[model samples]
Target chain A: MNEATIQVQKLTKRFGDFTAVNNISFEVSTGEVFGFLGANGAGKTTAIRMLCGLSKPTSGWGRVAGFDITREPEMIKKNIGYMSQKFSLYDDLKVWENIRLFAGIYGVPHHTIATKTDEMLQRLGFASEKNSLVKSLPMGWKQKLAFSVAIFHKPKIVFLDEPTGGVDPLTRRQFWELIYEAATQGITVFVTTHYMDEAEYCNRVSIMVDGRIDAIGTPKQLKQQFESESIDEVFRKLARRATRKEV
Target chain B: MLVFLIEKEFKQIIRHSFIPKLLIVFPVMVMLVFPWAATMEIKNISINITDLDHSTLSKKLVQKISASNYFRLTGLSSSHADAIEEIEFGNADILLEIKSGFEKQLIREGATNVSISSNAVNGAKGGLGAAYLSGILQEYTMEQLAILGIKPVPVIKTTESYLFNPMLNYKIFIIPAIITMLLTMLCGFLPALNIVGEKEAGTMEQINVTPVPKFSFILAKLIPYWIIGVIALSLCFALANLFYGLTPSGSISTIYIFAAIFLLVVSGLGLIISNYSSTLQQAMFVMFFFMMIMILISGLFTPVSSMPKWAQLITMINPLKYFIQVMRAVYLKGSGMGELTVQMVALIFFAVGANIWAVISYRKTTH
Candidate 1:
């Protein structure tokens, strides 16, 4: 059986009287592409934040890369990488500088950084742009570079939070190609996105509405079960059934 | 990790379009402008006189007062009320009311009073103006006594000694203190803006996910600016000495030691503000407000002793106030560590507390 890289059970999070991620449970196998989807303020961020070891769940339990979410968040941090919705690289810095900085922070050996960066640049076929400032890069190139930096240390899992925001459709498709490549290398890809069609690309998908996971299944299965033509309709149908308003 | 972080920080600072030039040029410009702008010595104080005597002695006194570079006779008031009006309406700094005393009084009694009134709106300006007026009157009295062949009896002489700065140059008194103020501001402001800029760019969120120690992150961010601040301070010292001819009387090492301690307090303050602020704009506004109040109450621009009692009490808690006092004492009075121990302890307490607060306040886990 494929090992469960992410195993979460009844994970819940609350802020005062409001529950942002209420009793959500799911798992993603090794090399699985798990898509986490929700409408605006539907608690996708809060749930993903908990599983990435960046936030503490209020109750229940979870494990990521064999580290307990509660007791070994630091160890978990060492095993996973994260990219946020907003661009996270220093725009004023050069491409190689950003790579070296992350490599250092993630504890990559100093001697190997130059070789690893060269390999990454060669793989991206953009060694010519390594010395250029990140701000001068195209939007699609910036998105691709950010993903590469996020997983540069070879964490067991990498969480992408709206990683393809504000990019053209062709670039968005290319971004997914990168995600698929990361997965093929045995990195668990946990991504949250607003694009409905992208949800179909995941090995397993979970839909969150008003702090609860409304559905979890393969894209074909979710569509067949909801009697819908596409995951978009399934999402819209399930989203309308949520009794609570977006917090 | 620390080395890498520091390298990245320095690279960003250097590559940014406007920051490196600003940091280097800021202190040089402040040193140029502050010594001349921030001084207690008055110049060209406008004066009004009502010389009622119409005699040679009184006319000579008026000429003597007006001839000095310190005073300019703006108007010759015909009556006492007009002279007083000139002072009240802000047209004059001082109104000299020479009453209707003929030159015969000085000839008979050997002494006569000249009624002088000053607009003491700003107490320091008025007090210095009065002192200048007194010096002219004393010189005139000495001249009259010498001319009349009257032996000035019971003459008490004061042989004065002005230590440290014999010339009493205001630049000598203030250059070191201005250095202290400029370093504090630049060091504090740069890191404040920088940390918040990372947050705005969302780079902080990525850093937050790493297992990087909170203390190391804060330290790595502040060290570059701290180094810049110290280097900038040393260059300012050299500039002050070369151009303005102001040098510290105390050991240069002592000033550096104090600066290192004080920089911790300043950079920690900046980090704490950045940790609390969510956006660059928010950080900028909050820092601007705090900086204005801190400088105003720091005794950098004004004498803390001259402030009201409660305000003076408030100054004791201000970190910049202690820094300014230490700088002035060391540079102007050659005050030793024994004299500066209290400020040192206060600064140490602030450095520890502010840095501890910054580390604790930095949210490693997402909210």
Candidate 2:
């Protein structure tokens, strides 16, 4: 297998008396599309937050992009990009301006920023709307733009938390095309989602139930192991036993 | 990276529909209107008089009170009961009663008493009105004694001269303080809202995930507001000079130096509030609560010397109090750094303390 981009062991996060992410473990290879699926309160976000260096785990440890999650969070941050569940772009900023801002923040070379921003805008077919405010764009376009900006720094791994949320199927399909393009360029994609069909697109999928990984395998392997015709049924069978209600 | 962050902040502020206009209009409106509305100098007290003795002395006293600009003779009743009724109905703030034997008693005994009653609900106005009436009566008695060809006992005379503000113009006293208040509100509230607004919009979460250091992020957030604050202070100074012909008596750079430190204290406080609050509403309420207490207790509208000892002690910790004192001293008294070292040191302490607290509280990662 290709070198592991993410390696975890017994990663756990607790909030007071409640454990948000239980002692779960997993790994993802370089350039693989890993789908992290869970119910509403199934601790997917909690685990993702730990991996993205946004929060510390209560116990145990993991590494992302070869940096210790706890001791080297800043190092991890420098090597990975993140797109949150909510729209996170500055709505008041112009399209090219937003691109230049993230590029500048990611330490893209100063002299090349203007040219790179123009090229990226043209590639996204957003060159015509370069001066328009981000808020003026439609939701699908905004999501696409946010995703593009997330990977603009060419990080080794990009963690996306529900990047296709609230979009129509056509937009989701287009967004997946961008993800596949990034993967082909050798960027690891760690995504969390509610859409089951989108889960079928992942090279490896993990279905989490009550903060525990109930199933983790290739789509066909999970379906075959669960004696089901599709990954959706496999997910339902594993998720039905969860005692934690959706929050 | 820090440059980019500050650029983004400036872009957001300029693109905001209301904030840019507010930056210009708010200070202009405050400078134009507040100096007139917020003056502490009391004028036009309505007085009621009951002159039972229609003698020359009583008549002259009545004329003297009426002629003074401070008092308007709103009522002239024959009885004290009627005069007191005007005060009860709120038409008058003070009442003076002259007995029927007033002039005769003064002539025979060389002394007489007149009763004075004032509605002290608005204590400053009422007290000052009664005091002016007493001065007028004493002058009338002295003139009467001279006309009677009676030699009076010698008394020591006191010459009063108001320092700093010879004319005692309340506008000149209040304008600098108002400017201090404007800086407090503008520099204080904007940064608090700026950070919390980013949180509410979820942009802060995105920024947190990046490799940007916390210090650079916070500095980026504070620097733009600091620039805006200095510009707002300049705008206030320009407007005050244009409309009221008021200029700081001291070096303008001295005011700027103190204003720069004061902005750090206020903006640091704002950052601390934003670091704790997650929503704009929560941040605004917390900021408003602190601002109300600070502005009121900072001696902006009232004298800190007049407050209770405990309240004065509280003002000792209020950064606004030190800044307002510095502003007033420099603008009105031509006080230089040598004369204002204590206030300067207090503000410096607050600036350092608040900024350190802000930087310490702002965490890049949540526990």
Winning candidate number (TM-score): 2
The numbered model that scores best in lDDT is 2
Worst 10 residues of 1 chain A by lDDT: A238-247
Interface RMSD of each: 1.3, 0.6
- Tens-place lDDT per residue, model 2, B231-286, is 99999999999999999999999999999999999999999999999999999999
Per prediction, fnat is 0.81, 0.89
lDDT of 2 by residue, A120-231 (tens): 8788788899899999999999999999999999999999999999999999999999999999999999999989999999999999999999899999999989999888
lDDT of each: 0.88, 0.92
lDDT of 1 by residue, B155-201 (tens): 57788889878887878877877898888788888878877888888
lDDT of 2 at B229: 95
Off by over 4 Å in 1: A243-247, B151-155, B303-313, B336-339
Candidate 2 displacement at residue B325 in angstroms: 2.3
